[model samples]
Target: MSIGKEILFFFGALGAFNGFVLSLYFFFLTQKKYLSNYFLGAMLLALSIRITVTVFVYFNNDLPKTYLQIGLSACLLIGPFLYFVLQSGIHSIVKIPLQWKLHIAVWLVIIMLAGFWFPYQNYPILWNNYLVALIFFQWFSYSLLSGFENRMLLQKIISDYANAVPAEKWFGTIFLGNALLFLSYFLGFSRVPFVSCITGAIAFTFILYLIILVLMHRKRTDDLFVFNIKEKKLNQEEAFVLSQKLEKLMLEKSLFKNPNLSLNDTAKELGISTHQLSQFLNNNIGKNFTTFVNEFRINEACEIMLSNEKLTLESIGYDVGFNSKSTFFAAFKKHTGTTPLNYQIQALQT
Candidate 1:
């Protein structure tokens, strides 16, 4: 083959190869086992399989029909996986829902049965002409649904790209990449003279790299995929009751005095799930657990400093539930905008 064709093949195949490795990394090697990452991994695996077949077929027209069938079968999953990636990421799903499991199971059965009934080796014409179009349309439909899932982010990206969150933009880029990839394949399927199946593979290579660049540029690789539950809305009455109960409990029991106080421990004390307590702290009080607890600690620390000027800051930090003097100083600076010594001096003068 000429150098130009060899270069095209190398670039196209490299994307699929790297994508497959990354999928495995996310699936079993990543330390954090997030559901969103699982879906993203699955989507990558599907894309790699499809793109591999496309590249091979573009270079070799006589590729086995069974390989084409397998590739197209993988194509059927790309859309659902794409949707799940967005849905799980946006919703912060911890456990895979039953509906999601069932959705995938049903699709798996459908494709398996189709392959069984109409083996592509015998029905190449139908698979190539009719089923390929169906697969592409299905993929496109999922792409649209994915857009709907992230509609707010898309609007933000379009209206105020400058201010949109890095994570949101990263996700939007993935959706746009998928759409552009579909366009490339659709053009080839339409028998556009200059476009070939390999065009989609080439486009995917560029899209894949662009996605990686966006992820790296934003420095969101860690936080973006980390599973933090979507904050739930707490109504005013419930919020008021919870806040009062929490404050009273903390004041009466001094739970924050424990240096190792945890969200789970506090939630158990409050007779609520950790999720509810987190929601209350985050939404109603506009403070995370640490900040809420630190406020009490800082208040007590200030009172102690005023009562006995001879007490050392290190002792005061431990007495006030901080695990270390440095943490106490940092939190104090963050909440009070002053060092412990400066705060004490200012208070004495006042």
Candidate 2:
């Protein structure tokens, strides 16, 4: 085999293998039965099939009509579903409501069925290209609208997992990588053969997948979601000062404006460690980072709702760093015993 062909085969096999391993890890090790798992599994399955097809095409010098058609169809059909699964998984992890899963699933099934009946020889590249384009459009449109939602949830998960540090940059990198992957696939389907784009998508997907697995694994063991109880029992005054400082930083720096800001992040910004910050909140503030941050965010949200009469509840919620309007309202009620609209009404009356 030529060098280029060898490289392609190696990377293809590597990507397929990594995807398979990660899918299995998620299936067996990860306790959370997230909808993303379904999509991940499907993606791995598709990748495995693609790898097999690539191998066969390389050796036989002839593509099986059924295999090529099915493989292309599956790849195109699976894209949106995979994207949605990733989207929904992030939401589920952060405890957000995402009702679009079923809708996406229904559409996916319809598309897959269309491909099953449609032969590649008859429709050929155009059929596959059109389907791929539609899938990209769906994924992109939903991503544009729901991207912020995912980021918000991602922020919460990172904060809960990383102690209030912004991991959105990492996740943002993953998103950009995925976008490029989609764009690459789109170009390839168009017969443009964007080699760089293809390689980048594969590489980025693999890297991000590994990063997420590591983060999730760490979060499971480290008690990231809870306060350090022993630390709370030890320090009082220092903890109080640290908590106040953390809260001040959160407010003054407009960190609450970031839906994904976490305590570990706060510690980094304040030139301290996550352990110190955790101790501070636990001992002095008597709450975890999530609650503390939510209190400030909800309060800010209330202020925005009262002041900006033209703003929608969701806009106000998003403006103050809450991921969803529901979360904003829930946190508002939890802290002040009033919904955002009610609070705004009362503020106006007063």
**Number of the top-ranking candidate, with lDDT as the measure:** 1
| TM-scores of all candidate predictions against the true structure | 0.65, 0.53
Q: lDDT per residue, candidate 1, 238-311, as tens digits?
A: 88888899999999999989998887788899999655676677667877678889999999999999999999
Q: Which residue segments of model 1 deviate by more than 4 Å?
A: 214-220, 226-229, 232-350
Q: Candidate 2, residue 83: CA error in Å?
A: 4.6
Error of 1 at 15 (Å): 0.9
lDDT of 1 at 177: 80
**What TM-score does candidate 1 get on C-alpha atoms?**
0.65
Q: After superposition, how far is residue 72 of candidate 1 from its true place, in Å?
A: 0.6
lDDT of each: 0.84, 0.61
Residues 27-47 of candidate 2: C-alpha lDDT, one tens digit per residue: 566565555555555655655
Model 2 stretches astray by more than 4 angstroms: 31-61, 76-79, 86-90, 93-101, 125-129, 151-174, 193-242, 245-350
